[model samples]
Target: MNTRTLIASALALGFLAACSKPEPVVEAPRPVVVFTLASAQVAPAALYTGEVRARYESDLAFRIGGKIVERRVDVGAVVKPGQLLARLDPADAGLNAEAARAQLAAAENEFAYARAEVLRYRDLVAKNFVSRSVLDAKETAFRSATARVEQARAQASVAGRQAGYTSLLADQPGVITAVGAEVGQVVKDSAVVMKLARDGEREVLIAVPESRIGELKKAGRVEVRLWTQPDVALAGRVREIAPSADAATRTYAVRVSIVDPLPALQLGMTANVVLADAAASAGGLLVPITAVFEHGGASAVWVMQAEGELVKPVLRKVTVRQYREDGALISAGLTAGETIAAAGVNKIIAGQALRPVAPARPAAAPMAVRPGAAS
Candidate 1:
């Protein structure tokens, strides 16, 4: 059984071992993703939360103090100019007016009697039947009567104005936003009874930081979207900018006038004002927000490159013009139709071989269904 049999068996075992296929090194397939490179008109813009306000708001108040006898209008009621909104009890005012008229009539009668007496005295004085002193005294009496008549006339005018003050009328046509006085409530002079706002001409008032004021000025026209009506976007022009920054907020008050007549727009409604930059809009590049990561004051996006049939993600410097909800507007260093890793960008390094994975879709909230709607 010797050396020849052992050598033959070993040779056969070695040949079998060599002929048996070693465990095949199976390479995983690269993850393929379907993407459409969309060319969108991206605006480089800064967004701010603003409030819609009426162009004219009036604080209606009573000119005179009195107990409110009647309040015809309530808050949110539409009113026209000169419409009666409230009325104070006019009994006292009427009585004063009557007294003033009666006093004026009495003064006029007294003045007339004094004038007749003065005429009789003057005739007698000319006929030498009355002395010069008596004629002089008569003239002085007539003049006193005339003074009394003038005083009565002045009182009557004041009483007339007081009577008119009893009724509070709307000075302008507007919607009543607030009502401060109630029926039978006593109010002092200059106490605001109601707040009126004009029907149309709405504007968004925003407080922009002082640092961004210059940038905002350069971005002339703004697009305003109502918070309640997000789908509806209205155009607005920069109407005014405050001369000085607010002491408390350190921001400048910027007013944007709404150009369209939006009947649905109401005062105090919240709005989003987007200030567009001209220079940034001229450039064309869109990058994923996740890919554009910041580290140590530098911003970058991961660009995928094909390395030996495998895609490798590499970090590339991107000039971010503006930050948006979905992604950042890239001003430079990116071309259209280029693939970039949307997520897992932090772990990836430049020139490192990566198993190209499909970009993760952003999670969305479930939509609320109304009653009787099909699911």
Candidate 2:
């Protein structure tokens, strides 16, 4: 054990210790979340925003002009057929009717006196006591009296109708939606006094783009969801499609009749309509909108694939039929039960190996709030 030997050993030990400091642990790549294409028997749909409206709305008007003396109903008041809704002052009408009746009675008495005079004249003429000119004059007088009586009767009938016109009545059962006049307000002939929404049926009216109108008509049926009650879906049929497009919007009007009574649904409520076709049901796939990517004026998606000892992603082209808030409907270049990257899609490229990731669970549906109930 010499001093030289000890110094050499100590230097060698120090060199080994410096060179062999434990290597830092290498970390594995972070895992990505992806969704697998699923084969869901979804009823294909096309959604539209619309409004609930009554099937028939009637505007009630006065047949004759007069000051409104009374209004018997207000907005939201329920009325039945032939129910009195309002009335004008009948004073003038009553006076007119009385005048016509008095004139008619006087004309009847005159007619009776004329008939007796003609008979007396005829008997005198037969006895040669009266001249032929006098008999002729008596006959003419009787005919004129009869004509006056007929004219009086017609005047009486006109007066009766005018009196009846003072009272306004409902022609059908309905809810009063509006009152256009107030008490003491002078209204013109045929002026609208009230608005009524008729019973029996209700409908949803929507405006759809002209380009989509043809497809909608071909689809045939749609599902309606009220904005107030998103969870409750009601069935509707395509009742009408306007032939002309609106000048400003370039969209056509579509009316959908609600098949069943939705008591909770009311007039003026907003609605969402879903339109579907057979092609959508048979061969299309729906994916979250975020998963779709654009490239060279075409739509593409990042799909996860397997590679030896590594996980990567590849971009594949697809055809987008339509876009939805939560997802998109793909017409081509994708299949059910295949995995695709939903997030971090931009970082992926063609033919890259990728490890499959779990799809995100769908969000829970919100609870429905009934009308007049606390939200």
Clash totals in order: 0, 5
For model 2, the superposed segments whose C-alpha errors exceed 4 Å read: 1-42, 131-137, 212-221, 247-250, 282-318, 322-375
lDDT (Cα atoms) of all candidates against the true structure = 0.77, 0.80
Q: What are the RMSDs of all candidates, in order?
A: 12.9, 12.5
Looking at candidate 2, what is the lDDT of residue 341? Answer: 77
Which pairs of residues have clashing backbones in candidate 2?
37-337, 46-275, 305-354, 312-353, 312-354
Error of 2 at 35 (Å): 16
Q: Please report, as a residue range, the 10-residue window in candidate 2 with the lowest summed lDDT.
A: 366-375
- lDDT (10s digit) by residue, model 1, range 174-194: 889899889989899899998
